[model samples]
Target: MNQFDTSITFPNGVTLKNRLIMSPMTTLQSYYEGTVTQDEIDYYTRRVKGLGAIITGAANVEPLGKGWQGELSVAEDDKIAQLSKLAHSIQSQGSKAILQIFHAGRMTFPATLSGEQPVSASAVPAEHRDPNTHDAVPRSMTNAEVYATIDAFGDATRRAIQAGFDGVELHGANTYLLQQFFSPHSNRRTDEFGGSIDKRYTFIEKTLESVFAAVDHYADRPFIVGYRFSPEEFTNPGITFEDTGYLVDKLVQTKLDYLHVSLDNYKRVSIADNYKNQTILKYLHRMIDNKKPLIGVGGVRTREDVQNVLGSADLVAVGQQKLVDPDWPLKLANNADDAMINDEFKNAIEYTPLNAPLYDFLVERYGSIPNI
Candidate 1:
């Protein structure tokens, strides 16, 4: 490998060809039952030709836990077989395969969950409105239900490993299930799972412990475990960089293999805040020590940005940038001059009202659309 080569070797001896990971994007492309289709396999395999590991779209663990209408799921035994096939397709190209496991919490729409209200740590609704429908109120998860959800996450991890995934990523960021527990604005519970900082962290601690135990017992290979966390919650009274640093300290002591850091939970900001801006990446680099591998994701678009962060962090996650060009990592690694993105990819990266119409047409014909 060259000196500037981005390939990284995980603890389990899986060698990533490059440090560019395809971050999970909820593209509403899977079937209603969340089965991976042939088109889905082809979409992911095309991206794996020149990337490191392909982190799959967030796979919901429970049906009621799903956040969107067409979100993917690995909650059932039958789904595992198709997911295994998806993993095999990526592995055939010599790329590691990992799945992002998530529960959308208050972010879930009632229509998505069969008219059942979405659940969260408390009765707090997501600060933002649903893209499809304008609703504010969301249901809350009971203490016992929270515990059950934690177990569900562990079960999902076991299922992912059984399906031949190299590892699983706990979706702790983006104001989802774990983020709902961590944010004071979202988690209003006064019980042990809420209140003080330590109390709020209890859910994540327990979830991580359960997931690690599940992998230990069920996974045939030494599965890699990691969490995607917000370096700074952008809402008022939300988690700050310092709070995330403390969380990182606790997580580093666990069996986690990497930390995927990003910014989320904003009440008011442009869509760019959710995707662009390199400031968050710099802050994340400053917050974390050199203990575990740190993966940074934001508006990173160029090779120079990749190299700058690579000097400090272990990996650079390309989200919208890769949506335009599946060969992004290869182009950067080879130092191509005309690697600038085109209009199509740029438009796809941004949120457009027409996306829904286009997606509806694609799903009708393809049976599923590939979430970037």
Candidate 2:
């Protein structure tokens, strides 16, 4: 049997049909208030072929967590109906649906929050990717607000259960709220939630506690819980590979169903000088010690690419490639590489499942979508 066709089961006893998973990719297709739109549902439903699971784009746990316009929301009970539609659309097609939940924290803009300043572990500003753009300095989250945000995560988890999702992946990566607390660059608090590395981890530890509690209280069936984190950061005083090792070690000892390492390439090496020899994926796998499945994703497109990533981790996730061709896994299964979308079909409105906004976002980021 082909390597990609192999099945894997999580510690929660949830089995994935294959090794392929659709990474959570934001489509900017949701309603302004973050409600799931029909376009988003159709897009995910069309991508279910031959995949084990699909993790929907990050859904904020609170209104202030909105990072940008058109982000999906699990912030309130009213959004559960639309979220249920998204989960059903993916699960009905034989693929597990996992909702990626998060809080944008300091990564958002004032305009996005209706003039309210973004809040974080501290009043620091995040570094913008675009050198020319200036990031707004955020206010420190009050102790009361900090506890409330943690509770918000718990509420979000309950909403996921009510919406019928198979799991929820905590968005602890991409320098979002979770990462902000873990990052010394953003978290300068002297309280219990900051100062030492272990202290900084308090927020994450507590957040996990809240999430698992929700599962135990509301979920009548097995539900997977995963954590995604960046191995290292580029800013000074940022999280290092050493720091990530500590975090991963602690996470592995928990009831987490899986650990996902976010990267631009699955085989990419650590940005830190001490761990540059081996890929971060292999290092994380070693730290996890096979206690939980490790998902490796970044720029994966072809069969060879998937195999290469699988060598280091238990699962391979497809991001940009899945967007380019929703049948990415299906094409690989059928050995129909030539049938993958080409330039002509890429622009064909009838052939593409992406909504207009998503198409514009893709074109603006990647010069014409590449083959999946």
Candidate 3:
């Protein structure tokens, strides 16, 4: 079987029809009230194309976990109705619906989370502005609050299953709550949840345990479970290659269906001492020991880029490519390489399913949209 087009089964017996996956990228397209909007539903439906699975934008696990004003929510029973619509819409197009569950942590603002000061593993304020809110001063999370948040992850998992999602990917990357705990630059606690390297991992470990507990009880089908993480952080006391190696080894022993590595470039070499010149994806593929699937993502825009990423990891995820052209993988499957991406941004309003908010955000962030 051609690797990218082959069907493979997970440890839990769930099989993805193909290897192409749509990575989760935040699209502030939901209703302000936290319900899924018709535009958001149509957005995902149009993006499925030929992808085997679609990791929907991160959904908040608690009221205080909201990262942006229009992000999807899985925090309550009432949300299941909209979540169900989302799951069915994606699945109806033959894509497995994997909800990316998350808590924004220090990345959120007090105003977004109902006036609660953003909380993190420690009181260390974020070095940069909170991207969405522009600025946010965060506080430390109490020990009890920590456990409560962990339980909230489990609650979110239950909600995902109840809403008929095929699986849930824990949002551990991108400076969220999970990353905040794992990052030395952010986690400075003297308690069991911080300080030593092993202690810092406690938060991720415990949170996964809680989430897995929910899956064990609620997921009667072969539901896939995955973790997304960034290999390194740029801070002074950041997450290093060694730290990621340790974490990868631990993940291999778990029930995780896959480990998704988030990177800006799939082949960018590391400057870390022992692993200088080695790409992060290559390092992780080795550490995983073929015990589980590894998804490599970042700047994968073409068929050749996807092929290069597939050379190291089990699957390739496209974020910006999806923004530019939602039918990326579908075109590739039809051997339509030249037609894979929409090169006409000016005509995006004519052919793109993107909501106005997302279209504006893309042009603002990327500086230029395709001339379509």
lDDT by residue (47-66, candidate 2, tens digit) is 89899999989999999999
The true-structure Cα RMSD of candidate 2 reads: 2.7
Candidates ranked by TM-score, best first? 2, 3, 1
Which order, best to worst by lDDT? 2, 3, 1
lDDT of 3 at 8: 68
- Displacement of the residue 267 alpha carbon in candidate 3, Å: 1.7
Range of the 10 consecutive residues with the lowest summed lDDT in candidate 3: 363-372
* Model 1 lDDT, residue 138, Cα: 66
Residue 85, candidate 3: alpha-carbon lDDT:
93
What are the RMSDs of all candidates, in order? 5.5, 2.7, 2.9
TM-score of each: 0.86, 0.94, 0.94
Q: What's the residue-level lDDT of 294 in candidate 1?
A: 83
Per-residue lDDT over 1-372 for candidate 1, one digit per residue giving the tens place of the 0 to 100 score: 122364677655666777778887766667888888776777787778767788888999888779776667988888998899999998898878999998888877778888787888988766666434435566677788988989999999989988999899999988888988998889888998999999999999999988988988998777888899866665777876667768988888887888887532111122233434445555455556666778866656677666765755788777766665667777876788386564554354444222453245444533442322
Tens-place lDDT digits, model 3, residues 136-201: 567889999999999999999999999999999999998899999999988999999998889999
Clash totals, every prediction: 0, 0, 8
